[model samples]
Target: MESVVLDEIDLSLIHALTIDGRAPFSRIAAVLGVSDQTVARRYRRLRRADVIRVVGRLDARRLGHVVWALRLRVAPGSANAVARALAKRPDTSYVQLASGGTEVLCGTEASSEHDHAQLLEQLTETRPVLAISAQCVLHVFRGGPAAWPALTTALDPGQAARLDPYPGVAPSEVVLDDGDRALLDALSVDGRAAHATIAHATGWHESTVRRRIDALRSAGALFVDVDIDERLLGVHANTLLLMSVAPAALSSVGEALAEHEQVAFAGATTGATNLVASLMCADVYALYDYLTDRLAAIPAISSIETVPIVRTIKRGSIFGG
Candidate 1:
């Protein structure tokens, strides 16, 4: 279960896995000063309990994918039909039924502005759709999976210790073939590599390369040809707001935060800072002070742990080391 509760050690284990799904249990145990068996047992329990899942987080935009969030209002009795139809497209990455209810979100990848329009058209053409609105996938928050309290202060030392943990992966995982591996390696170096150049380097026909790329996209293993320049795009500043909210204030606080355009991602986890958010801002000062003022304004707020990003480790194309 979803109902399974996580202690500090469990949270730490989660942090480790989130960073690198393939991290070995032994390595995790070493990092946590626990036995490998302890790490394995805890992780197995988490897996069986459906607490955490290990999945690849590839850069979709790097593969030339422009992510968008489509809100679909389907005709009565056609919700399932509409969802099924939308799910079939390779461009679609995430689908959700928003809290207000029947509006289904189809988060997907698009080749370009034209492709996004075509995707919206396709959604409308589907029999069940009554109306559809698509919001571009502006940003993805690489943060804790769920609501986590103030791991920096509120949670027990053992719990907070796992706030920034590590883990490893096993062999026989989703191993990449030569062609795909080479492509990824190249893109890792230069995400904007030209198609003809890539084909020349790989000695594959241009069409063959294209097909393989298509296959990767359909499989949800790769994202090609995405154009996202956050700095130039005016979403230059980023902040990780670590919050400590009283249980009574969580509803209002969470909803209010979620409604803000600045909030890129939100998660509820098992720590003192019950809610964490990734926010984009206009500038360094704004990012810094926005969270400061918001947290101070909340009466139920106990403390705030805001981590302004120093170096962007990896984004659509930018990478640190």
Candidate 2:
């Protein structure tokens, strides 16, 4: 797919959403100082362009499912079909063809690496694929640098760069030696840096410069991404399906629901409600119909609590703990 580039106003609308998706068009209009109709027109355009999607964030770990990053090597001419197939799976969300050929980045609800492998095995029985590399996420960090700033911001020195470029992974930019530290401190305030500048200023061996950066990433700490526009906190309405289960069925059932893309956070808590989930989505109507039909297909559920999130106070340990 081609990239959708937004103009300045479009970017502003995104930032406003990052702050609060439910933000009324009247309110957004006030902030952006545009008429409500203008806001509406632009929003429709953004959606049509596919540059922004409002989605719900499910706490999968809480829900009893594991999330994984998938890299797939596909047969020639099969990338689109494979992606379309994976996209249909409730267990699979977020398929991207990355810089690598036929690579796909997806989030799933698998509690462990073994669980994901089993899922792949089951999937292969139906749709055979070439190769798959998977990474289990340890955590997801959220809410850093405030949208536009986050998009443009580099990691501040000594501060762990907020927002893991890779989900559930830590930033790699934090480990700067004294010399690298000095140079990075300069670049933190400014991204553009000349080689002589980094070298002369930091007093490091110039030959080892790029190597240091490689060490940071190879160590699993550093990543950089283009800044994201602020989220007004986009809305993906979710159904909270609750269950009555025998003690033995509690863990596995909760785990299964959590892996569903529409199911967000899942857990077995004390109450008439044995399980809970926060489903993430963009199209509320589809999600609503999906829950009533598809999730209802799962007999374990007896009750469901559906809610739409209005705002996020904070996200992840990415915030100062």
Candidate 3:
């Protein structure tokens, strides 16, 4: 890894985009008090460095899908191989090699009982995979751009309002039609893609494209996530926290962790350890402080296990779609 310098302006730009990934450069410039060209230049620099990406994703729950986190003990020297294979699958996301490169951790989504069974069967039958444990994510407390407090804090209320996309009401049991799927496929590739471009791809009028996008957003069927390389944010440590909490206090502890700025995401899961959290910190010392001061305050927590992620093989997405 090489040293990267990010000034306050860069941070502000990132924060603004996290609020709205497709925000106009002029809008961002006005908020940050910089020229649009400067913001554009900085965006290009960051993109070239692979330090950040803006991606659109379908809400798994709305799509009738359930998410699973898998912990795998792989055969020696087979960890990277197995990880790459898993990464190539559209269902798996956030694949990483951990635990001395012999353990693989990743998330995948299953739409049905058959889908879930096939996934388990595929991995268990694989020769390189020795043991596996899969935890079904029951509910997401906080995740995606909406939960990144550090980025949002750079702007005051007024500035944030200027960049806000003003998404609409959440929908219940909103199933995806073919047109919806086509539109989502376009967005999954590039969250910031122009309306005209998406229209061309989906064979719909630009106005229709915009309308569908707004509808999906309002219905809570989609989200725009700005994926920043935490390393570039001076946060070099990303750890998975598996926690066991008293069943009665599960919601309390999970909600508390979700509010912590250091927490990238937290969820309640099905397993012996019912709560799972992904945390990012400036360094090991910062992570220790978070665990001791913030996490220790949660009296319901009975146990915690931490694992450092060595590499991100694939961002959770559909298998090679």
Residue pairs with backbone overlap in model 3: 89-319, 90-318, 90-319, 91-319, 93-316, 94-316
Give the Å error, residue 32, model 3.
Answer: 2.3
Among these predictions, the greatest lDDT belongs to 3
Question: Each candidate: what lDDT?
Answer: 0.53, 0.48, 0.81
Best of the two (1, 3) by TM-score: 3
The residue-by-residue lDDT of candidate 3 on 127-214, one tens digit each, is: 9999999888888877743546766677788888878787444465667787776777788778889999999999999999999888
For model 2, residues 64-165, the per-residue Cα lDDT tens digits are 455554546776666666767776664554444433344443445564668777877865664436776554443332222222232222222222222222
> What does candidate 2 score in Cα RMSD to the true structure?
20.4
Better of 2 and 3 by lDDT: 3
The ten-residue window of minimal lDDT in model 3 covers 312-321
Residue 159 of candidate 1: its Cα lDDT? 42
Tell how far residue 26 is off in model 3, in angstroms: 2.1
